[model samples]
Target: MLTPYLAMFLDGRGLNSVEIGQLLALITLTRILGPNLWANLADRSGKSLRILQIGAALALASFFVIFIADGFWGLTLCFGLIMMFWTAIMPQMEVITLNSVAGDAHKYSRIRLWGSLGFILLTISAGRLIDWFGTEVLLVICLALLAALLLVSTRLREPEQLPDNSPHTGSIWSKLKSPVFLGFILALCLLQVGFGPYNSFFTLFMKDLGYSGMQTGLLLSLGVLAEILIFLKAGRLIQRFGIKWMLLISLALTVVRWALLAHFAHLPWVLIATQCIHAASFGLTHATAIQFIHRYFGRRYQSRGQALYVSLAGGLGGAVGNFGAGLLWQQGQGATQAFLAAAMVVGVSLVVILLIPSRHLECASEPAR
Candidate 1:
């Protein structure tokens, strides 16, 4: 719902590509700052759920202001505040989930699959709603969901801390300075930068190539569907291939996938086919990274470790990529050229993965229940 309306919202305001890109960059850059700040508090208080409820409430309230705000500055202010609150939700949720799964992290797939399922259901329903009622409906529905989530979130209890196995840690900055950890962060940052344009403008790209809105939703669904399958079996794949290998494979596949879409988005089937690679490009990479950090970082620093990773990779990388893609998309160099640029970034990321030290790896089985 948010995906489709994002470009339209800016377009509705008559903002140029550069302004749109900067707004998105500003929005996502909060991801970098928000997570680390909240992550530290969560660790100190061991109150992930409390952080989530508060953040969600703030986010919900902030976004409601968006429906009434007009003009660029007003929208930007509200949106930035909303993003600051919103960005805090996912990293903490992830930490909560990690705590819930305890030692048998492999089973994360079973639970995480519901998120993908929700996206599919919501994407289809939201698409239909937009088709019938228009994009404003999307914002209204988003506001409603956020409000409902804020209410329901209070019921979630924080998981009891398990016997933490992670190493004792210093400051977040020192951990980040480790060569291997630094390498992984850099790789993920580059990887997301490559993805920024696709996430920001893929629908427009499809429409430009003459695909209809319904087809665009279906194609996006295909990517999620592929992700569902991978989540179901990602543990087995990770055990077989290891995190480093999985990371390499995902980056390689992303390079191929983005390159194909860049040049061949005109063919609906071809784009659909390329979408299947999301399983590796997104699903595998995500699962592997989380597990990898769990194994490498000490239990005490889990939140900090995850936040650091997300801040650099998801926050910084995503911001740069979003802005760059916006500029490229606006330049009218066409989707093909923009996608090719993304592919090249992923290619560089693959090399970075290859350089990470093998000594940091330590896979331990969860004790039998």
Candidate 2:
């Protein structure tokens, strides 16, 4: 929703591309610290739902400050605070949902598709609203959405886990050290690093290439639409191909997709074609990795499991990519250069995945129950 308007927003506030990238990097950096801490808190207290609710409430409140903040630094302060609270929801929520489904954790895909659907609907609607009313409407609308999320939070019950039968107190460190799991995270970070330029600047890039606002929205929504479909079938795919293979393939495709983006920005069909890869690049990789966490980590450590995944890959790796891309972007280098660098990141990630042993994958055969 904020994608198209970000360049304009930052430009209006006197930030160049590099400064905008730096701030975006910082926003994601919060997840590196915030999510792991919150997940650990939830682990000790068995209050994942409560933590989620509190984060929602805080997110709703922070937007009030965001709407009123002036200048880059003020907005940065507001964004930092808001992200610190907002980043905790997904990791723990994944743990909750995995626990909820129990033996049929493969059904996670069907459940997660809703988020992609929400993004598709909101992205299109937000574009139309911004075009009709102007970009300033963004904060007000986001505030309204957060208010609704606060209400939504109240209705969600904390997920229940199967009672622990083992005598040994399990540590998250042991669960995380499985080389396959670490390799998976490294691969995803590279894949997402490739996506950094696309996420932060795609709308502006399309506009520069002469696409209309509505067209930009359609293109963005198209990728999410593909994601929705892929997510619906993720469980089956994970069963058929296994997580390690899935990660490797997805990262490989990410390299190709970003290379295409770098080389073919002006070709309409190429733009559309590149987005089809969302299925593998994001949907498959995300679903597979989360499933691995569920398989490797028991219910007691699930929140921390998800948090580790989000923090290292989506948070820190993504921040590095976004910031680096921003520097390249501000140098007056073309979009192609940013995407090419992303492709390189993914390539390195692909090499890292080769070192992961497949024996750790035996757990995928066991149901979450």
Candidate 3:
């Protein structure tokens, strides 16, 4: 509800397109710092659950100010503070989920698919609610959900032991300097950068094309439906084809998906087709990234690894994507150019990933390096 509806809400509040993008960028920008800060604290204290609880509470509190936040700076402060805490919440959640699955990357999908279910439910319902009540309904729904998250976080606990027992004795700096790590980070960041326009403006763009809120919601949920199917078989797909090939498939399809959107979004069927490939663009990409992190960062540094991935890829990449999309959009006049550039960026990611050296793969089929 929050992410899909944020730009619309801010737009309803009278913000311009670029300003909306800037605010979204600012939110992601906090992830770059917030995750690292909270991860270090959790690593030292062994209180991942506590930290998440605290962050959720704080984020909930900060977001309430959105109700009254006026003007650019005011909205900036509100979203900035919320995202700072939000960054902490998500990385902790990922760490916990990964630990619970005990390194079975495929099984992680079983647990994660529920999130897609909820997203579908909320997105469709919110669309109907918005159709009846207006985007202002978003504020109330968002607050309710955040409050529920705080309530849920209280009941969460750490796993009895982390998944990996191998001692993580190497310096983080040394690990960070590896060619594979560098390549992975760079490619993933660029892939996310390629997601900028869709993430920030897809809904508004659809609205401009004369689609109703309910139609837009259905289209967004259609993507998540594809996401759910992919998550179900993600582990098998990765195992059969290998992470290297799977990533290649996902990135290549992402290139196609965005290009189609660039040229054909005005046609409803094209939008539907692009939505269908979200499984590759997001669900598969995310599952593989988690697999890579789980392998690269050992138990001791798992939280930090998660934080770093979230910060660099989701944070830095997302910031560039949002800000760049806003500029390319030029208040809806250049939607095609914005999406076209996104396709090109992902194409670059495809090239870089292909050059990432397919050695050290765990199996003949899968690249589990």
Candidate 4:
């Protein structure tokens, strides 16, 4: 909801493209630091729900300050503060969801799919609303959503724990030192780098191509709608194909998706068709990555694993991608070149993933249900 219109809102508020990119980068940058910090507190205290509630409260307060924010620095400060708390929510939620489902990793998708539905509803409606009411309405909608989050956070029960028998790991740092784990993290980072241009500039790109706000929202919703369908079937797909194969397929589709968008933005059908790839690029890949983190890091370090994923891929990778895309887009090379650059980055990630032995990429065995 807020995503599709955030860049536009900043633009409407008089920030130039570079400034908008910088502001977006700040949000991602905080993800790098914020999640791990909060996760450490949650894991140590066994108080994830409490932490979530506090973060939501702080986020709502910080975001409200955006109403008064003007110029780059003012908006940057407020958005950064908001993200400091907001980024903590997802990693904790991932841990909570995984814990609740116990050993049935497949069920994770069904629980998470509702989030995709929410995203679709908000994004599509926000687009139409923004078109009708102006981008300033974004702040109000965001405030309402945040307030709802705070209220909901208070009701979330502690996750039920599964019985554990696996040997305790030495430390997260020791596990991080392994070649396979390092390779996986690096590959994930590159994948997010590939996503940078699309995340930050796609809406603006569509508008420049003369698409209306409703069309922009519909296009975005189309991708998530595809994502929802994938989530509905993701459990079965993972069981059959394995995580490694599914990840490879996703990377391949992402490559094609970006290329098509770069070269054929003029064709509405091409754009619409390309949106379907979101099922592969985001839906499958994200679900698989969460499963991988659960298996790879084990239960003791689950929160840290998720935090690392968010910090590296979403945080560092996204910041770099948005910053680079903004600079490139401003260089007169146009959106095509930025997306082409993204494709090239993903190509590098493909090579990295290919280097990992197939055995290391195999899905972990399920625990007893």
TM-score of each: 0.94, 0.94, 0.96, 0.96
Writing each residue's lDDT as its tens digit, candidate 3 over 1-369 gives 679878888898889999998988988899899999999998788788888999989989887898888988898888889889988888888878877877787789988999999999999999888899998899899899999999988787776664345433488888788887888889999999999999999889988999888988999999999999999999888777777888889999999999998888888789999999999999999998888786677767778989999999999999999999988888889898998999999999888889877874232223223
| Model 4 residue 109 CA deviation in Å | 0.5
Judging by lDDT, tell me the better candidate of 2 and 3. Answer: 3
| Model 1 spans > 4 angstroms off | 167-171, 331-333, 361-369
lDDT winner, 1 or 2: 1
What's model 1's overall lDDT? 0.78
What's the residue-level lDDT of 286 in candidate 4? 91
Q: Candidate 3, residue 150: CA error in Å? A: 1.1
User: Clash pairs of candidate 3?
Assistant: 242-366
Residue 188, model 2: lDDT of 71
lDDT of model number 4: 0.83
The clash number for model 3 is 1
Candidate 2, residues 126-166, lDDT tens digits: the string is 77776787667777778888899889889988776577432
Please report, in order, the local distance difference test score of every candidate based on alpha carbons: 0.78, 0.78, 0.87, 0.83
